[model samples]
Target: MIKTSLVLFFALLGLNLFAQERPTEDPAITYANTITVEDLTRHLTVLADDEMEGRETGQPGQYKAARYLEEIIKGYGLPGVGPEQTYSQPISFISERWQEIDFVINGSSKRHLWDYYAYPSKNADRAKVMTDEVVFLGYGIESEEYDDYGNQKLEGKTILIMDGEPKDRDGVSYVSGTEEASVWSEDISLKLKAARRHGVETVLILDPNFQRNLSSARKISLDSRMHMGFSEKPADNYSNSIYISSETAKTILGSSYGKVVKARKRIEKKGKPKSVSISVDLALTQQKKVKELLGENMLAYVEGSDPVLKDELLIVTAHYDHIGRRGNSIFNGADDNGSGTSTVLEIAQAFTLAKEAGVGPRRSVLFMLVSGEEKGLLGSEFYVNHPLFPLESTIANINVDMVGRVDEKHAADPNYIYVIGSDRLSTSLHEINEAANEKYTQLALDYTYNAEDDPNRYYYRSDHYNFAERGIPAVFYFNGTHADYHQDTDTVDKINFEKMARIGKLVFYTAWELANRDERIKVDVGVKP
Candidate 1:
């Protein structure tokens, strides 16, 4: 009887074992597994090498970087977007240089570097020599209430003006507010634009402050000769803008300088418009060269499997451009963006592999390798303004920048990553990220730089800000600032490849979840300035 009972117990245990089911596998984990450290290092090895020449914007090095990225995505079998089905988006810009500046006021023969300075107009394309009657148009501010050049014959003429708008008796500004001056006074471009709109051939701005800093201004003028401005389409207005000292102004105004100075004081005391006429022959000779530069923003897309959900999109971005070489020392920004650029390529490969294996996300993914990020996020800005895909259908942007090296704050902690702008426009995005990290990567998601008042202003610094400004939720992956940031020392030997891979996997998981979730992540948080 004991043997029979034991046999029956064994039989019941066997039945229970057979009836049990295997646990379901998470797709996010499987897809994220494709991002490997070896792959990231291999790509970074080529991208951050000295041969790339820092990937400067509009330079041959930048074009090589673009080709490398284009070929990379093409290898993944991702197709290009739009009718042309090309992977490159063209961006035309004007690079200006100050070739020459010759000015003679009342035969005094003002010096260039010592007494006066001038720069080629932003829209200047050819050399121009202007000889016109100089008219003192006060501050040259024109608006509904204040018109300094009102009804004045300013067409085909030169205008002399002063810096800063008219202030009240208490030094308060009515154009802006009681405490601060308006955009007219603070922004030089606005002042120049106003002068050009008046059909003025030249604008001589009497800037005492600039004159005091003439030494610094001369250095700045030489450095800024290669200033670039976007010119894909036609733009209006060109004024040969010059900044002169008070002494130069006096020489041009002759005996009328004292009266003009007194009138300026009166306007400051009473907050009134004081437009005067200065009779002087102004002649300027400037040899300007405006070279049109063509830049390309790389784009490639992987189609989603789900019929209905495939319309929604997720974007991954990283800038491949750097500060270029200063002299012979190359600013090889390996960690600044080379790490992020490699991480993006790895993420794209992982997504492409998942799609091929029939475990792809429901939503499409667009990989963008942009240029001109170091120059002020110009590539991403252009993308958002003129997107290949509809901005509305795009749910979020995952931007990676400077994720290779550890900063002072994270030196002691290896398992850390800087998470910015995750909660700025969407609470759901923040929660999803926390859940994904907890489930997969346990790296500490530091929000130190996410504070609205954070001095670094990390949110507005990266390419993600462009999407966030358009109300699309974004997450910026960073390792915080390091000593070698923006320096020539940010080399490939310094990047933590293992840590970079972990962060890349974390991004993959987030994108995977965002792309395949039952519903899109809701924009539930208010955007911060």
Candidate 2:
């Protein structure tokens, strides 16, 4: 009787497996194979033009750009995303104006607004700290294998450390153990978590030029304006941070720890000892606070042609908003992302044109242009937390950041494109990218950010990083950094439209193939950097 029941169960299981293997439908093809550069340039001109005032987030100009994108997409003739009417998914967020801050070192006091800056932190409420004991921890780096503090207690003490992990030109921090170098590329909230884990409270990163040589106070301030609840791990008992000059660190850690600034001769000799102690007394004064600062991310979609594949989705994204009017001079983010958003519009047009021609993609595509990127990838963060589409059905995302300008290395060629993070996650996506590149636009695909030990950490910097963390395959298209990167002079006039078109064409083609391919790009599990 048992044998008979086992045989029956096996037969039923085999029958079910057979049913699962049944072929449903062929691959999807959404476009009519007729997307041109001229159409792309038209959208690029209006979006990247200086008249948009760099399309700063939450500014009137960005709203105009979003409205313009809506109008343009409407003319493309695809079905609306939401049930109501137009193609918009509003992501709610809050903005805080850090109107007041006062910090002092060695009897010298300065306001954070002018002397130091503070980006908003992703915390529940006001995280304040008064006079506290500060400790000088080298790099504040901790590892189970080789603890920098070496069993020394760092609890309830402020830490002074260097900027980044120790490494060569290649990004290999060469330090063994993951604990010491576990710093992530998200907001300052993660840093706070790291501090808490290391048994430290207030942190004073002494490295003046740590992590892109960015100002610590400024980076922290920018991160604070982000939406609440963005972090997987909150800032626990740890809070309050600042940066002091190497000169100031010397005064703080001079006696037992030696001079904060090391001499060149020290490099020739054995490195200094690992641990030091500090006594810190910080009193942060709050002044009159004012206006709230924040931004928004725009979302849209085009459905798939095939019913089964329609369940799956593809994401094409870019950051539309730039730095708002700061002083008399507004930071025009034309090439930074206006070009990216404009290119997305053109891609949408191409997809809609194909759909009208009865060749719409098999898998749906969601077009997203986010804000608060200049303020530290805020718009993308908002979307990840509150997605318009289900993340499970989302297969992949292709993010375009700055593809308008010719890279310094390819200034003369004008036909090259920088590809980052495509092969980092999914081997299948990497194969698809290479195959698409070969079949479509033949621009050079540079992977300067390919090395696992690369210093820039490009994989974690762009909007694509947000998608990748969710296990979705993603690619970041950049023209590589140039003389004007993050500078006010990154004007549209300097952008190589022809080069931009070529890069855009590559993006359009890549998305076209991925949207229509028989099998969706496979996710590579177990791969880690």
Candidate 3:
């Protein structure tokens, strides 16, 4: 009787649906089609396995993670978007490390050498400066409205200055009437670039943080890698970069007297050049030769259905590389981004399932697992600069980084996932996300990282910033930081698979809405700092 009732209920319901002639727009169907926790868990189990050796970037573990992602993408019956049968991108960077750096001031000509301490330049070649006079460039910034150059030009000169952008007259980061987030348009790097435009040889930052981290800077340089291209030639060169203590700097500038100090003070005061009173020679000692290593950024695209809108795409990105190995233990990164990478794989699967169910999206999707994110957003930086697809035609990007752990601040409720950059560049993208959540999983969506001073630097830390830099609407999902954030203990067992699945589902729903929407989100809302 139970079997008969079940069959009869289904038959009657089918007849009623046929009578209603209901379209396929039913919410019930979409919800039923979503992937389950078990499905997502199996994938995570394999990717986050202990044998993978923590999946460090540039290591065998990172290669293992890459192969796993490729195999899964292929198993889903989707064609490859990369060249021929490969999904890997090779990338490298020219890195440097300093050792035994010392200098003296007060014209005593005394030199001091410290262990792996000095300023390291990102220049492609080695430079040496033995006793070059350091010019105080103030903020080293230049703009049309207010030039920080102090009406002076910088060419073939090494500069010294403060770390960040200059504040307004009120000592705040922004102008009083310019809005709270106006600082984005005022990047100090832009000022440095201006100096670079005048052929500046090297940049020497003298911020307190740089002063304290001289040893790390040298170590990072010594332990650096060349991102792309190779060179067999030695790195010996004519110019070199180094740092002097504030006391030494004062003495050295005392030769120029009032000019250098006055310029630095003015640069700090209003971020404008007050003018230079003297010139100092830059002497560099060629240190070492630079070699090239290889690495790459990965990109793939899912062709869209609609002819008119196929050119417009939605981007889904995450970084696959971690800090590589540290001593004996591997940084498995099960959470830092192993979590985000796993979620991307699952999302690709979910979308494939949707396609099989004839619910494929109207617009195209590009699923990218970038490299070198932990290395100062290098991979995404390259992609944005040399995209596989046109940037302007790309509508938006949704980035996933470190989504495995429930933030300790919000550990009491494990269902939360941090969302950042939702409304910064595009209000419509933000709206689509909000509406989709209300209609889908209904999990608690958190945006604690959205605050300007939240300090985690989530906005500027990940691949999404690359897209945001080009004025593309972007959203980055994070699960906050933990005790093991950059440590080797961010292992697989710590992952909350169930919560991870829910977060993936949320991302899926949001992407689905964006993919099928008739119009792409607009970026007229503008970005904040």
Best by lDDT: 1
For residues 79-190, what per-residue lDDT tens digits would candidate 3 score against the true structure? 6665564565566656444443334332244343332134344333443444354566655555554455654655666767555555666656522333242432445445
lDDT of 1 by residue, 1-529 (tens): 9999999999999877764432127766766777888898999988888988999988888888889988898888888888899988876555555667678875546778777886544435335454636777778788765668767778778888888887777777756647687778877777777777878777789886875678766775576433334642213655667788877887888877787888787767776677667777666777755666567788878888999989999999998889889999998899989999999999998888888878887899998888988878888887888889899999999999988889997788878999999999999889888998999999999999998889999899999999999999999999988789889999999999999999999998888889889899888887666
lDDT for 54 (candidate 1): 90
Between candidates 1 and 3, name the one with more favorable TM-score. Answer: 1
RMSD of 2: 18.0
> Against the unseen true structure, what C-alpha lDDT does each candidate score?
0.82, 0.66, 0.68
Candidate 2 vs candidate 3: the TM-score winner is 3
The runs of at least 3 residues in candidate 2 whose Cα sits more than 4 Å from the true structure, single-residue gaps closed, are 1-34, 95-225, 229-294, 527-529
Query: Which candidate leads the pack in TM-score?
Result: 1
The segments of candidate 1 whose C-alpha lies over 4 angstroms from its true place after superposition are 1-24, 95-293
Worst 10 residues of 2 by lDDT: 23-32
Please rank every candidate by TM-score, starting with the best.
1, 3, 2
